[model samples]
Target: MAILSSLRRRSAAISVAAVAGAATVGVCLTVGSASAGTVSGSLYRDPSSAVVRWVAANPGDSRAAVIRDKIASQPQARWFANFNISTAQSEAAAYVGAANAAQQIPVLSVYQITNRDCGGASAGGAPDLNQYQTWVSNFARGLGSQTVLIILETDSLALLTCLNSSEINARNQAISTATRTIKAANPNAKVYLDAGHSTWNSAGETANRLRAAGVQYADGFFSNVSNYNSTSNEANFGRAVISALNGMGLTGKRQVIDTSRNGGASGDWCGDDNTDRRIGMYPTTNTGDNNIDAYLWVKPPGEADGCRYTAGSFQPDLAFSLANGAPNPPNTTPPTTTPPTTTPPTTTPPTTTPPTTTPPTTTPPTTTPPTTPPNTTPPAGDGCYASVAVNQWAGGFTANVTVTAGKSDINGWTVTIALPSGTSVTGTWNAQASGTSGNVQFTNLSYNGRILGRQSTTFGFQGTGTGPGVTATCVG
Candidate 1:
């Protein structure tokens, strides 16, 4: 049960056609991978990730050749789980079944947290907590008996500040139940709670949150998810979190790191315009750290963060830059075939449905091996753990409040923040705000009514308030 590596799949306009009676399912999305890193075991086939697909579509593009050779052909993870239970179940089962046929361990990204992405780039998930529970159960059915890498709910823990109390409670309950269920369904399944990135949450807070989310029952935790935090930095951060967990009597737990986009560190993680980024450590299980298990590419390099291009689709230039400028090159080289097939697979290419947020579009695939599939991180926290940012301009000022669900979710919740006298709310997002000055009752919108455990969400408005020291207090 030693999984020494991880994966990061790319998104695109692609098709994953399931081959009836075949050993594997076809995924249409084309993604690229790192050109450097260690490999504990063979990677699953990814004929459809962004890099591969782009190369296929424009074979004559000279700049893409190096990336085409180094990354597009490399294997990555296949993400699963979405709004529909039946869809998640079928997709997961199909991908797992294909991996079993290839004898390659598959990496699964379970990312359908209710109100996922907290009304951001990757938004929209199961309608409610109950629907999410049912969806997770159905997703577990896909694991079968094979060893699978399940990165549970990316950003679920780190984004706790986005939720209110009731949502937090429900989120914790959801994680505990999902972990137990996935393990029960497949004893060989290795589950890892998403730990966001080092820049986001402190090690102590991350460990505490994971514990509350039932990390004790998981294989371990994962860090630098799709982020550009350097591997060394992430390792240090990960070790701290692991040590904190050990202090809590949670020992023998190991963690996997995503070295996909951390070629160089970034000062602004939320800034989608970052390009100093490069590919990081190759996927391998032999990472030097004892507490740190493996090094993986949980976030494919070329996939946009919804800033430059469509959020998850592939960008050739970015992929090329990452592949070409890799600080440490991979030990192995991929094949030079039209659709690189370093290791020919037996199962057919499986067509897949993109995550619910956006639809995928692709033409066709030459051929792909049946292999296992794939694919967030957390943000920073302050002492109060709950605060808001305000902007004051001349005659008017704007206020935004982020309410944390200290220990539980805010179900059918209401949030109230104090406003200065003579203050009036002009607008807001993801919430409803009313009342004036001292008592502004901000109710939940239908889409974000329920917050996940340890998560938080914000609502803001414009109003006339005293300048500078116009302090505000928020409560959920």
Candidate 2:
């Protein structure tokens, strides 16, 4: 993303190249100052996280220094939205109570969509709308007038395509009900809804989905949650969504973008390797663009995005990479009016024949163990690799894939896998794809588009896997 600086500001211009991942951003770096850690007016230091607990227990390990200095030392979020029926109320009360005691506003992640994750890695939510309301009621009771920033759901709108009309209606009802419940409990709470990212849906499409899901009751929308899309890309994408919302007669809408791990935007959404990841603009209210409330660490650094380790496990080494690699704001920003890149069939370099003898560069290793145990093993593969499966049901299954560079760094990859006579791509995560001409063409998301030599990234689809056999063809 490019930061527009007044040419009069010499320091910002010199600092432009100072950003850790400046080269990876499409818009050049040029930003004003910003604050670090949690948002200002916070009641207290961040609640102790898994990393904090680990540091307290494993103080002697070499990584403990970095963990303590970087990951454990900062203020990040505490997710109270996971499926923990027995503890939901108490946990919610405890978190808010702690923030209350410290006199700080709290930040919470509330994933309350009835069917939550679409049967993907982070799946499960309240069984139905009634139960969801009960759960949200318990959650909201804890906020009681304290200032807070609430991210209602990470992918609430994206689920529209996977559900039938009845299911969609139910989901929207659940969202609207939950929004009212939260607001009724604490009218001062700043609530935001999900808009996926610049790459996931068009502006009008996202605005329509947000409206359906009850944007009227929200502070605004948020984008790039738990993904690595560029800040500029997300900023422009967010503005577009906001404009669309306003065009529909909604006014004074605002947005928030996740800056936790976007320091570098290689578009590596599905890859576990994050050495290239950089720190983004710190959480602050002084965002140059008034439409943006703040640039936040929505997905805490060091937390694995499923592919790297167990989904959401906090990795210390990765955390250290994030802390050490991020540039202090004066950071980067993208244009508000920029349009999103079009998704379409595109040309990529040809794949080559491999001898049974020669080995390709190894995919980069994921970081050390996280607070939660991590599965650091990368999917074993060669240059430009692919893998597929037909195991969901009689007509459905999940497709897990991998792509590694040949002899040098790669900017993009295209993997075309032939489907059986009746199979088609129904949904995807960590990347984008289309099913046509009897095959599925999957490509990288913007932040994960470029990969270093030997480093790899992955993407997948959920669709009709009708074949008795499946094969992959890749180009990088």
Candidate 3:
């Protein structure tokens, strides 16, 4: 609801400003950078679904392989650890196991703090604050190294309207305590408290909440963690919130956004009856705004937010629909309409006249012409293409690819590279890759795999490159 409200305000402001300035401007000048990133993995759930069941059923299925490959291909991806405090220990163990076994990159998003989603749509968190803090501390301990980009709680600060003063204070204290505990546990961990988004809370109000929650102790705040608003709008909103925070003397704080489902911002609220909206943006670590740390796929793109199916249940169909851009009108099957055809009659008349003609031949002087070929090779080490370095490690390979071409920007482009035989790609970044005998194909590997242009991203992976003396070729 807060996100929806914020989006409404943005839409109105943008519209009014466009109309008022249209006369002088002649054309509407919308100024903003696009977001980029890749949504490689599904929202990991303990209980499997139809798709997951299928993946489990077929051990080496190509579809399952593609999904795994896509996930393993990306170096860093935002993983939402949605386990509640009640099951925090087990969930944490499972998470650790998955991280260790997969050797996939981890960027954790810790949800389940305070009343999630303002008690409107989501299952609320710990009935008391102490339990919440305990859960958070345990969760932090579980995270060892593996550089976590922790989203402290979703909508915790934004959903403060429902709580009384005492309740609010208690909740804020709990968050502050949790922040200190997590940071103490892992100094390398980048903890981000949720600041909701611009559409949800005014900059001043959100800043007040962040201050109350002790944002100073944390890395910064997170915005648009699980909503569908454009990164540009979210960035502007984040800047405003940060500015307000700075005004409140909370300066130099940063924020990250959930770019998992916001390919484009929705015009309506979460539960609005309107069905014409489509999902925009994929998942990646590229943020258009420099101040924003990473545009992570905080919300698993296709996971329903307690709407489409029995509220809070994982609906794979809905997830898939949302992933592939949620087309409107629920279940409209027809893609196109057939056009009627009209045929025209054809008539031909032939008249032949025979005539003898003598051909005149003229001899022209022959000279050898100079031949030169146009330059076909691209400029060396340009942004258009990147030559990534792959370091073959024990069970897999490790490499860090630096992009100076589109640093801190998201550009839509694909990355193609080849890997050596017997070496299956375990993971990657900025894009998804499918591998054959010796050739590994990366498709839709945009800047950060899902970000716009002018951004820099790092992807690393480990794989069981089969056979002794296994090697891989990094060819784009």
> Can you write out model 1's per-residue Cα lDDT over 1-476, one digit (the tens) per residue?
11111222112222223222212121222122322222244556555444555666565677666775556655566665346666777777877887788676677777777876565555666777656766887888878997777878777776654676445545754676688779989998888897766766667777767765667778789887745667888888888988888887777677888877777664344214556667777665556567666666666667655545655556677677667866434544333443433332221111111222221121111111111111011223321123454433345544445555545555655655656566666555456767665666777677655666676554445555542132333344
lDDT of 3 by residue, 309-333 (tens): 3433333344434433332312123
Per-residue lDDT, model 2, residue 143, is 77
Off by over 4 Å in 1: 1-40, 266-272, 327-476
Name the lDDT value of residue 47 in candidate 2. 31
Local error of candidate 3 at residue 260 (angstroms):
1.7
- lDDT tens readout by residue for model 2, 1-476: 11111100000000001111101111222222342322345323343455555555565777766555544544455665455566667777777777788576667777645665554444456665545666787788877687788888776774343566445544654675578679988988888888867755567667767766667778888887745677898889888888877776666778888776677866334324647777676655546686787676666666554454554555677777776745433333422222112221111101111111211122111111111111233334434555443223343444445566656777878877777777666666556776543766888777667867776565545555453244677677
TM-score of each: 0.62, 0.59, 0.52
The global Cα lDDT (0 to 1) of model 3 is: 0.46
TM-score quality measure for candidate 1:
0.62
How does candidate 2 score on lDDT?
Answer: 0.57
342: Cα error in model 2, Å: 50
Instruction: Give the range of the ten consecutive residues with the poorest summed lDDT in model 2.
Output: 7-16
